[model samples]
Target: MNRHRFSTEEISIFRRSLLAWYDIHKRKLPWRDWHDIDTNIVAYRVLVSELMLQQTQVATVIRYYETWMKQWPNIKSLAEASEDDILKCWAGIIIDSIFYWSYFFHLGLGYYNRARNLYKCAQLIINEYNGEFPNELETMINRLPGVGRYTAGAVSSIAFNQANPILDGNVIRVLSRMRCIGSDLKKKSTTDFLWSLATDVVCPERPGDFNQSLMELGATVCTPQKPKCNECPVQNQCLAYQQQKEIESILDIEQCSANCSFCLKSSDVDTNRSLVEHYPRKKSKTKQREETSFILIIYRLTPKLEFLMIKQKQSNLLSGLWSFLEISSSKNHLDQMNEQKRKTYIIEEIQQMPTIDTIPSINNIKLAGQCRHLFSHIDKQYIIYYTHCEQNDVLIPSTSMQWFNEEQVQTSAISTAMKKVFNVALPQIKLKTSNGKKNGTIDNYFKKKNSKV
Candidate 1:
């Protein structure tokens, strides 16, 4: 049995109130500013923005979105871009999201999924759909690489003006409050209930605006922290607000048919509880598993200054970008390795490298220091080290290992964590000053020496 039902009149009021609020208060975003509403053009822009936004904040994606639009401009252009180029742009140093990190000395983050999916989506649209976004949500959901139900509904309603339903975090929050649902959001049952409500209230005449309004209301007014109920245009329709006021028994609301299976019990709503902030309940935070990464910034001084880089196996690529050779283990394991053990481990790892034709005697390598990079789930420590070839050893490059001079490393599409490693290392790899003093930087050495590959 349906727990809640909105009448024709009630749905009408929701549309009018929500659209009026959205028209006046929607954030000034680039995707919303298109002057000409060509269906293909709108779909392309919407697809890129929506893909970039997955698991990311709007404030963080704006610049990347702008740059991406200018660079590609259309589906055909994006379809032609290489995987490396797509990954480079999509990750854009992976600035938008922090969700790709993990622990337990296992599995590369699925950070590459978004980049790979979006790339495949554009190509499919170009090759299969004749360079235009499909007009129907079913086609998109079924055929497009990364277009899931939420993305499909968004593209359908916004680009094609279809009355397809959508659900994202903001929508989930807003609807949960409006309906006063107090169930665990992580559960699938709660999500199905919300999706039903979304399908019900979305006005066919203005589905895009209506859906955007729900998200806008959730983001700006019905926020997770401290919702501004006093300013909410739909506060009259919101069950949570009414419950807070004790204005009327919730069961008596004119539109609802059955008692919600998920509503908070009356006794659970303490009189001491504050305003409308108690609508949608939040689950407790998961305890994050912690780990540390031991990184090596292996370098060579032959011919000129250069850093050795591993062609990183797919399992180890961070954010799906190549990294220098490194190891991951628990902090306890790292702590147990004494100075001599650490030195021995570094030497053996180098000796195993196929790139070095003749590594010098064991004394050339030295510990450079430490740096840290924070990910959403993992707390990582980069234990840095450096070594130099004997200035005359012939270095052989492999498909799995190669040496890059400072400039090449700087210009390469390195991951954000890798960039931090370079920053920690540059100052530590001391350079010789003109007076034969060892007080300069490798950053300067590259500029003067014109280092070879």
Candidate 2:
């Protein structure tokens, strides 16, 4: 592979072509609005856009971004808003596969924490910087919660007009193909090299446009599968193109560290293909860990139907969010328990609850269908159970427990996992109610039973 650096003339040509192409083809995104160039406004817009775009598609973020800007136009406003409101705004923006991507970055830290950090970050900026977003790279990184190298660089360069480098997935793809970087993109060495190259090529005069152009090029022309090589502005300077043309002659072979399937060059004609297709190789990703848990959808009728939900402690995962009563087991424990054992375990755990004695007989508990929730690193299987009792038999609400009707549950600060569980239980409840039995009748019967007792 050609590892030579671009000449000064070549670099200028690449920049000129890229910028010209971007001028005509650049996506007119809400955050990229050039009408409001005020530094403070620009910084806030860039920061919010960056956070929203994490593992999210541009189309998906546009609506959310516009809505968010309308609702919380400034950092102070966002800081003043409750966490539940912010999270509810963030709900649908996270697409299915992208959730996994976010999970990978956050690992132990759930995506809800991102919302929490964004809140804290806004508060910090308001308190320390007097509500003005910091322009300096180090200041932004040090002050903002969850603001790392990429986010800091992006905000500094795009909003503040500072000459900084950014290396998001799109930028990485563009760089890897441009230089024919065969090393695993996940390696620290490869990342450092790419950052250095990005810094080197960034236009000093218009660093924001330069960086954004590279990213836009990757997003539009140089896509991962079936790249538009003919339409790429920087194709003339791309070493991958040159390598693809000459791969037929170079006999000496080296195994690709990325283990990519596309660029395998062999002496056999059948195996020979363009090496350009595999320029930006990547190591295989680890499989998602599978886990099993039991979610209890307990309800009570006291003239009105209310479902049981638990508020997660502020310190654990999904902190501050409410979810259904769940008995979760790690993969190891799941392996130890057979299907029957798992069912029994769930029942025993529910029976052991302090408030269990207050509820009527558990004989009527019905096993609802299972639900599958995919996180970044975990594939969770949730077995749902539905049960209800008379209002007088229901336990009193505690700090961590609450009873909510359907509408309340819809608006409550509930996790997506719990929402899935609710979705599963809703149909079951609807089916039961659809058959002759009326909610009002059930409620009156339970109320009369309580009064008589």
Q: Output the number of the TM-score-best candidate.
A: 1
How much lDDT does each candidate structure score? 0.74, 0.76
Candidate 2, residue 339: how far the Cα is off, in Å: 42
Model 1: lDDT to the true structure: 0.74
Q: In model 1, which runs have C-alpha deviations exceeding 4 angstroms?
A: 1-3, 96-107, 247-260, 266-275, 285-453
lDDT per residue as tens, model 1, 1-453: 333456677778988999998999899998888877788988888887887777567886888889888988888888898888777876653644454343122124656687788788888988888887888888898988878999999888988899988999889888877777876787888889889889999989998888888888988998987788889999888877776678455333233334556765543443444535655665764334467766776666654677877666566536445577676657777789998788787777666765444545545556777888777555678887776655456556666667788888888867777888888877766443221234266565675567543
Which residue runs does candidate 2 get wrong by more than 4 Å? Answer: 1-4, 95-109, 249-273, 285-453
Candidate with the greatest lDDT versus the true structure:
2
Please provide, for model 2 over 1-453, each residue's C-alpha lDDT reduced to its tens digit, 9 standing for 90 to 100: 324346778778888999999999999999998675688877788888888888577887899899999989888898899989998887656643356566556655666667778889889988988888888899878878889989999888888888899998888888877876666666787788888878878887788888899889988988877788888888889877766665555442233544433233333212233455565664564345688888878777654667987788777568888888788778788789876677677777877866444445554567789989887666889988887755667566777788889999989999888888899998777555443254466566566557889
lDDT of the structure predicted as candidate 2: 0.76
